[model samples]
Target: MAEFLLEALSEEIPARMQKRAAEEFSQIFTSELEKVGLAHEPANCFVTPRRIALNIDGLPLQQSTVVEERRGPRVDAPAAALDGFMRSNNISRDQIEERETKKGRFYFVKIETKGKLTKDVLPAIIETSLKKFAWPKSMRWGSNSFRWVRPLHSILAVFEAEVLHGELDLGHDKLVFTNMTRGHRCCGAEKISVDNFAGYQDQLRKARVIIDRNERKRLIQEEAKKLADAKKLRLREDEALLEEVAGLVEWPNILMGSIDEEFMEVPSEALISAMRSHQKYFSLETLDGSLAPYFITVSNMPSDSTRDATIVVGNAKVLRARLSDARFFWDQDLKSKLDERVLALSKINFFDKLGSLGDKSERLQKLVPTICEFIGLDNVNGAVKAARLAKADLSTMMVSEFPELQGVMGGYYASADGELPEVCRAISGHYAPLGPTDACPSEPLTITISIADKIDTLVGFFAINEKPTGSKDPFALRRAALGIIRTILENKLRIPLKQLISKSLDEYPHLTDSNELLDFINERLKVYLRASGVQPDLIAANFEAGKEDDLYRLIMRVKALEELLASDDGANL
Candidate 1:
């Protein structure tokens, strides 16, 4: 048995596409190997921005030799036919045997085919795998009809530490295989030669390239934290961004840069969003948990004081430009009270089928009072007031630029406008628990507004028959349902889905989809409950009892059934 290594070097693949491409390409190759009876050891795949390397160990030198019988014409067949069969099998009449068959006597020959060497078979395997490989988005490079995520440059194929002979036929060009591979685009050597996987990795590292993305991520995190620690600050942890940044560089050099004090005055979220989204820079925080006036960026080159200073300065200049736009939106937005932006909501459509956001805002104002029934019975005029401005920030310039900060900026702007703290918190948190792990809002007023907003959205969309289909919730209606379920259950609020949904459907005249919307929410509840360790059968049993709209009570009944089922007396029944 020997090892095999194949590396395909290409132009920079988009950071988001790099890992998946490597994984899918690895799967294709592994499948091809199995199809050819090359049952090898597990394969390890490595990816960077510019290359994908695969290593397979303990593969056989060649396939196993096999013996089989081939049938020939009947004994009475013509001499020409018998001669043709003998020639095809490379045998003589003495080598042939006469066999009695149901039809008649026939001629047969025993054939032994030699196993092909693994090296000889691998080129065809590699070519077949490459042709079968797919990308999320691919492009044709130059005039070549064959496509890759980027340009297909060079291929490195080595088996048993020997360069394998192979080539991929591009429609307009051909890529001959070689043992040669290039390193980092700018800082590394132009060309490097290797024999085995270990030497390939070592040579690439010496040439200023890191073949493994996880190692690059680790180096980036450790070095970045050290840099922040030196300045009495710490790096903000974002695993997603770390993965992305790791994909953006072959060699990560962590460096810290200053943030202009004037730009720091902008909301940290806005500044952080600008840095992360536009430049992929990670933010730092001070010892007291305040936003630090510095950012960490990963460079693809070595960290030399003279040259590194130039890179940091260049990165800071770009960041300064991005933050300036964020700052301008902040400064300009605060000039008018957040309430003044409510009219602008009319100009922004919530959905093409659903009315404008202004119309939805009006619906929310009417919906919150009904929602206050389950959360709080007494006067809810204050929550209704908060609900009126829940979506006001959707029209703000800052939100237009950074749409992810819609509710967050609204909360900030509302505080600046001297709005009640209750209203600010309510508006800001109305979109909480966006996903399964997101924090669910517990404050009564905030919960009230959130439930109302989500319910209104669910009703309007369902009223128009725009419910989410399998694996495709274009409007994220499932998330909205999950949000509502999380809020009701987490807050221990007793909400009757049938009644609340019926009342919400009334807000949209001539629409009678209350049962449909309630069923959707109930399905989401089942999903949420199953994730929390509840039995699906018990939940369904409780639902089958009919009109079990109060989620809290329904859950209590299901748990009671589960406990009973666990008991001997109930088990007997």
Candidate 2:
């Protein structure tokens, strides 16, 4: 038994690409080994910004020999046929054995294939795997036709105590395989030799590089928490930001930086967005859960006193510039009422043929009242007001700069414009339940407007024949449909989707029957129900009972039926 270690060190691969690349490297390597009948224990892959490494253990020194039986021409066949059979099997007439069959006697040959040493077969497999490795985006570098995510610097291929010696033809240049790798580029670019996986990891760590991404993530998280706690603040949890920052560094040095007090007046969301998106910094919140005037930045360098101060000051300066820009957008956007920006939406295209956002907003304003009437909600005025102003912020300078703040900015501007509080809340909540785990709107006005917004978009797109097909949902119609399903189901809304779709389609004179839209909604409902752990048959049985359009009622019936089926008599039926 032996161990194998392979590392491909390169220039910084994009943080988003590292994990995927490592998986590809491991999969390709193991698959190639499998094709050659080389069995091994479970393989592991590790990725950092600069490298993808793989470690395999308990691999046989050589593949097991295989025996194959080859049948040839019958004994009574012509000499040429017999000759051809012997030639094809690479066997002479003397090597062919006579076999008795029901029809007649035939000639058969036994062939034994000798297995090669693991070290002998691994070089070609590694090279072929490297050449065929897939990357989302790759580039050819330095006159080489071979492409990689970045310039390939070295190949470290070791099996047990010996290096797998070979030359990889990377088109313009050849990479000679060796058991040598370099550690953290900033620490020292000196060659580090290793005998096995453990040695490789230990040397890399000593050289200021943490080869395991999960470990790097843990270090960043723990250190950031400690730094925040020391200042009586808490770190705002951002798993996505943590994952990305982990990939951006080999050695993470967590440092706390101060935000300018003037910038704190900007909405915490805006400030946080500016810091996280632009500078990749994590915002800190005070003990009372308000935005603290502090942020945490993870540096790729060591945390020496001088270096820490320099990195912190530099990041703080960068964050200040971003927050200043955010503050400017915030102030400039408040200069006009949200309703005043409504007319400007005429210039912003909603889709290719669906007219401008102004057109959609108009439809929503009309459709929301119908939805409110159907649901027997008396807040028709508030729903209509919110629907009208929901997308008006799309024209605001703040939303233009931070497109993610569209509905959120509307809420702020609506409140500033002295709109009803319910209307403002609805305007902000219209885009809620963005995903399965996101919160659904509980306020009556907010729920009405939210459903109205999603329904209008779904019907408008389906009418234009732009509905999501398979995996090609360019317009995210599936997500829109799912959002509608989740909101209705979670809120236990009693509105019939069929009637609501009909009313929404009526707003668009060119659009006709809501059958297709109803089917799409039903499909999304089944998906939502299944995800919520409801049995498919139960959902089908409930739908089969009719009144499928009333989701809340259908769910109740499904639950009741599920309980009935759990009983002994009902189960027997």
Candidate 3:
């Protein structure tokens, strides 16, 4: 058994792309290894903003020779066949052997394949993978036609505790393989030498780099919480933010900063989004669950109390500037009534092919009443009112400044405009069950408008034949479909899928067959059920979306059948 390690260290990779790039680098390399018949344990892939490294263990130093028995033409077969077999295998006829079979004696050959040295073959695998690496986005720098997620700095490749000799071509330049890697750009040792993965990780750690993203996340989370807890404030626990912040630093130093009371009066969501999106800072909550005056940030700098305070003060200064801009957007947006902005949406195109957002807003207003009537929602007025104002915030200055606050700013403006509380809630909650973990909108007005909003967009897009494909969903139609499914299941609404789709489709100018859109949602149902732990076969066996379009009833049937299949009688049957 032998060990192989590879590290591609470069300029900081985007936090969003680091983990995926690391996983892909490891996978493509291992698969390339597989093609050359090198069997090894799973690759241990580590990632940070600066580097993606892989350590593969238990690999044979040389591929084991393979022996295969070949059946040739029969003893009396044509001479051409014998000659062809010999030529195909690059072997002489004398190398062929004779074997006795039940029917008759037959000509056979035992072919022995010699194995190549793992070290000799490894360079090609590494180079091929590096050349063919798939990055979501890549760039070339310094007049190099060779593109990477970032510029190539160095390649560290070692096998069996020896440096694997290789060089990677970078269009105009080249990266020679080495056994050395540098540590933290600012703090750690400038140069570190390593012979194996164990030593590499240890040396890198001492040099102030934690390559493992999860460990980085753990450190940030635990330390951020500790910093917050000491002041009797709670860390807001934004997992997505935490994952991203972890990716931004090789070494995380948690520091807390104070917010001004003036900015605290701004909606917590706006403050949180501004901090999160602009500064990558974590918002702290008070013991009573109100937004605390303090914010927590993960810094890449080394820190003592004095240095920590300096870092926090600097971050706080930046935050204050950003928060001031956010407050300005909020103040500017409120000068006008929420409905006064509705006309401006017409200027904002939903898509060139589809009409303006104002058109979509009007469609939503029309669709809401239909949903209210279909679902017997008595808050028809509030639902329609909410639908009208739901997208009104899209044109607001605050949402333009912080797009994450689109629906959130709408809710705030609706409350300021003194719209019904239900309407404000409906507008804010409409984008819900954003992903699997987010809660579905349960309130009547919310459910009414949200479903209407999703349905209209889905049907219109499906009509345009702009459906999401295998690798791409530019419009997030899959998420919209899943949101619809979850809303129905969680709210136990007895709405017919096709009827809802058809009503929403009626609002569109084009009328394609509704089947494709219906099927798309059904496929999403299969996905949703499977994610909820319903067995695939059971879902396939029980799913009848076309015949039973009522999602609540459909899921109920799936659940009942699942229960029956678990019983002894149903199991045997």
Candidate 4:
């Protein structure tokens, strides 16, 4: 048994591309090894901005020995046919043996070949691996026209203790590999030799670089949590932001910084979005759930700057400028009439085949009353008014500048428009339960508007044959579907999903083939049910056996069916 370590060091790979590159590299290598009869256990791949590394253990040092069998022409065939068979198998007539078959007699050649050493086979594998490497976007650099995600800086192709030297010299100007790598770009700045994977990781760690992303994320979380606790504040839990930042740096140093008093006056959401989207800083919130005055920033460099003042002042200045622009947009948006802007949405195209935002808004205005009655909303007019204004924010300059603030700005704009308090609240609440565990709007008016808004999106997209394709949901239809599913189930709404989807589609006569869309919606429901630990067969059985308009009733049936399966004498047969 032997181990292999392959590393491709390049300029910073995009965070999104790193994971796939690592995964595909290992898979391709393992498959190539297996093709040559080399058996292996699981291999691991790790990725960072500057490099991708793979290590495989329990791999055979040589291909397993095997017998090769070749079938030839029949025993009584013509001389030419026998000669052709002998040529194909590279054997003489004397080497061939006759074998009896049901149809006729055939000649056979058997040969045993010695296992090839891993050392001799790996260079060809490495060369092929480089050629077959898939990059989301690659570029040609230097005299050679070979394209790569970035300029291929170095290729540390080693097998066990040997360097596996080859003709293709891989490196940048004056940067050559002699079985060596550099440590922390900041700390050592000098190249060091490594004989194995353990030496590489240890040396890199000593130089201030952490190879594992999970380790960096853990350090950031722990240090940020400590800083938040010390400040008597809470870090806004943004796992997506945390993961992105974790991948962006080789070394992470978490630092606490305070926002200016004026900037803190900006709405917490806008402030947080500004900090997160631009600066990659995590916002802290006060115990009362208001945006705290402080934020946490992670640096790739060690906290060794004089008094750590360089990082602090630089980040604070950047954050202030970002927050200033946010405040400007907020004030500018508030001064305009939100209701007047709702009329302007008529110009903004929702889709060419479909109508504009205004048309969609009008549809919601009509649909909301019906949905409100179905949901038993106490204030029918309020729900309809909120639905009409909710999408109006899409036309506002503030939302245009900060797309994350669409629903948020709607709530504020509705309030400024002197609408009912409940209506204004519903503007924000209409997009509730964006994810499975995200909060669902329980308020009657908000629930009505929420359902009307989401159902419209689902029907509109599915009607256009733009349904999501296996994790490639560019239009976010999956999220919208999940939101609708969560809203209906959590609110315990008795309204039929299919009926609402059908009713919404009926309004858009241009959108034909709606029955297909309805079927897709039902499929999406099964996904949600399976995720909630419901038996997939039970969901399929219920969908096949029952015809219910209410989503909650369908889900309750699936849940009851699952419970029945869990009992002592439950019959699956």
Candidate 5:
């Protein structure tokens, strides 16, 4: 048994690419080893912006020898066939063995393959991996003609004390592999040579680099939490964003940066979104649970600077500038009525084949009321009005510049337009549950409009033959369909999906054939049901989009049926 460490050190890999690349390296290498009759107990992969590392445990010292049996020509076969079999097996007639069988005795060839040393196999595996490794995006750098996620920095392929030197000619003008690695750009103790994994990790830590992303994340969270506690503030935990920020840097430094007093007047949601999206910063809240006047930013440098005050001031200046832009857009958008711009959406293309957003918005107005009644909404008028004005925000400059804030801006504009409170809320609420855990709108009016808007998008897109197909959902129909399923089941609404989808598309004469569209939704439902722990086949057996009017009831039945299907009685059926 022996331990192996394989590291592919490269220039800064994109944070989004690091995790995937690490997983691929482990999966591909494991499968390749198995293919060559070499097996290890378990292999672990770790990744950061600088390198991908794999640690294999209990790897065999050498591949095991194998005996192979090859069938040859029958005992009484032609001379030519016998000669060919002898040549194929590398044996003459004297070496061949005759075996008795039901169809008379047959000639057979037995061969044994000698296993190669672990040292010899490692190099070939490493070279093959380098040549065949897959990446979503790669590029060639300098004149070397070597392509990678970034320019190749070093190849630290080591097994115990010996580094595996394969046939790969990967070296840049200044970088080459010899078990040497540089530490953190700001804090570590310069270049050092590592004989093993421990030496490698210790040397990197001294050089200011945290080679493990998970450790860097822990340090970040601990330091950030400490800062928040000192100020008696609560850290707003954005775990997804935190993981992303963790991958963005090798050394994490946490600091609390103040916001401009004037800029604090900006809505907290807008301010937080701007900070998180643009600066990769986390927002802080006061002890009383209100958005605090300060936020936290993680810097990729040591926190030993005497100019920390100056750094916060400079960061505050940048935050003020960004927040001012949002405030200006918000103020300007509300100075005039949004209704005046509803007519302008006709100029903006929603889809070339399906017509304009204005056309879709118009259809939504008619469909919303029917959906509201189906969802048992008491405020049908409010929901309908909200749906009508939802896309109206698309014509605003704020939404034009920041397209991600479409629903958000609609809520703001609706409030500014002096619409009823429920109507204003519904405007933004319709897009809720964007993700699995994102909140579903509890208000009936909001739920109705949300269902109508999503259904319209799914149906309209399907009508135009743009349905999602296996691993290719450019239109995000799957998400739209899942949103419908979750909203109906969560809200306990009784709207029949097929009826609603058909009625939504009924206005478009070109969508007369709704069969495929119906099937698309049904397929999407099966996916959703299966994901939510329902047996797919059992769900299919009991519930379908075609016959079911009440989606919520159908989901309940599907779940119950799936439970039975997993039981002994249903398994027999």
Candidate 6:
């Protein structure tokens, strides 16, 4: 047994693509090795901005030899058939033996196959894997017809104590595999040689590169928190941001920078969104849970007093510029009321076939009143008001710049415009519970508007025959359906989904009956219930009982069924 290591060094890969690419590399290599009768103990994959590395432990030095039996024609068959079988098996008639079976006697040849060295098999595997590598988006560089996420640089393949040298034909050029690789592009660009996984990782670390992405993320989090603690601030946790930052650097140097006092007056969400989305900086919060005047950034180089100071200053300046733009949008948007922005939505297309967002908003306004009535809520006026302005922020300058703040900015604008409190809350909460685990709105007005908004989208899309199929939900209708079901079940609302969907379809003149839309929502409900650990049969039984539209009651019945099955009498059934 021996260790094997392979590294493909290239230009900086996109942060989103690094993890998936590393996974592909590991899966393809290990599965191919196993298919060739070369079993390995386990494989570890590591990725950084500039490299994807795989290390396999307990790999056999060579494949095991095996004996195979080749069945031939019947012993009494024609001479032509016998000759063809013998020729195909590369054995003469003298080498064949007669075998008796239940059907008839047959001729068989026993052949012994010699095993090949692991190094010899790996070249073909590596070449085929590279040629078949799939990237979400690939580009051809120079004159090469070979497509990669970026330009091909170098490949390092080592087995035991020897370099497995081979050439990868990239159509226009050939990349020669060797036992050499370079480290951090800035801090260490010199060639480094290694014969094993342990030596490769050690040398890379000494050259100012951390090839392990998880290690980089841990260091960033721990060191950033330490810096925040020293300044009497807390790091606002963002795992997505942390992963992205880790993928953007080989060597992470956590540096704390301060936001200007003037820009801190903007909404914390806006400021945080600006820094995190545009600048890739992590926000800090004070002891009182308010936005702190500081943010943390990770640099891709080793830390030095002078260099760190310059990096911090440069980052702070960039953040200030981004926040200044955010502030300007904030001040300008406040001068106009959210209701005034409603007219501007006509210019923004929601979807090519679904009409404008302004049209959707109008439909929502009309649908909320009926939704409130069905749910037995008396706040129809407030629900209708919220529906009218929920998407008004889509036209706001702040939301135009930061599209993630759509509903959030509308709430701010509504509050500033002196709208009713329930109205403002409803607008803000309409898009809540976006995912399975996100919070669901419980207030009457918010629930009414939220369900109304989602129903309009579902019915409109289904009416146009644009429903999600398989794994391709271009409009995220599945998420919208899931959100609706979660809100209804969590809030214990007895509103009939089918009835509301029918009313929603009525509001759209061209839309037909919403039976198909109702079925779609039910499918999403089953998925949601199954994911929540409910048995599939329980959900099926509940749906079969004709309580699918009333999600709360259906879930209650499911719980009862689960309990009944847990008891003695029902267990027998």
Q: Over the stretch 1-573, how does candidate 6's per-residue lDDT look in tens digits?
A: 998888888888999899989998789888888889998887899999989899888888888998999888997899999999978878876899999988799998999888999889888888877877798998998888888888879989888868886878888889888999999898799999999888899999999999889999999999999999999899999999998999999999999989899987788999999998999999999999999999999999899999999999999888888999999999999988899999998999988767899999999999988887878888777787899999999988998899888888899899999999889989988898787778999998988888888888888888888888889999888989998888888878888877787788888886665547777888888888888899888888888866467888778888999999999989898
| Tens digits of lDDT, candidate 4, 230-249 | 98999889998888888788
Writing each residue's lDDT as its tens digit, candidate 3 over 1-573 gives 999999998888999998778888888999999998999998999988888899999999899898988988888989998999898888897889988999887888889999988988898888899999979999999978888888778999999998887888888888888899999999884888899999999998888898888999999999988888899888897888888998899989888889999998899999998999989999999999999999988889777888888888999899999999989988988999999999999999998667999999988988888788777888877887898899999998888888877787899999999998989999998888788888999998899878988888788888888888888999999999999998988888888777778777777766655547877888899888887888887787766444567878878888888889889988898
**Number of backbone collisions per candidate, in order?**
0, 0, 0, 2, 5, 0
The per-residue C-alpha lDDT of model 4 at residue 59 equals: 73
- Against the hidden reference, what TM-scores do the models get? 0.91, 0.97, 0.92, 0.92, 0.91, 0.97
Score candidate 3 by TM-score against the native: 0.92
Scanning candidate 2 in windows of ten residues, the lowest lDDT window is: 510-519
Judged by TM-score, which candidate is best?
A: 6
Q: Write the per-residue lDDT of candidate 2 for residues 176-213, one digit (tens) a residue.
A: 99999998898857999998999999999999999999
* lDDT winner: 1
Off by over 4 Å in 5: 77-95, 170-177, 307-310, 535-538, 544-546, 556-573
lDDT of 6 at 63: 88
* Shift in Å, residue 339, candidate 4: 2.1
Candidate 1 or 2, higher lDDT? 1
Give the clashing pairs for model 4: 496-549, 496-550
Candidate 2 matches the true fold with a TM-score of 0.97
Q: Give the TM-score of candidate 4.
A: 0.92
Off by over 4 Å in 3: 68-94, 100-107, 509-516, 535-546, 560-573
lDDT of 5 by residue, 1-573 (tens): 787877777778888888888888888888888888887878888887777888786778888998899888788988999998887778867778999999898998778888987867887787667767878999987777666888776777777667665646654443333566667655663667776777777777777778788888888888888998998999998897788888888878788888877767666777787888877888898878789888888777777677666677778788888888878987888787877778888998988677898888888888887887686667767766777788888998777767778877788777777888888888877887788788888888778778888888877787677877678988777777778878877878788666787788886767765446656666667777777776666776775434565667777787787678789998898
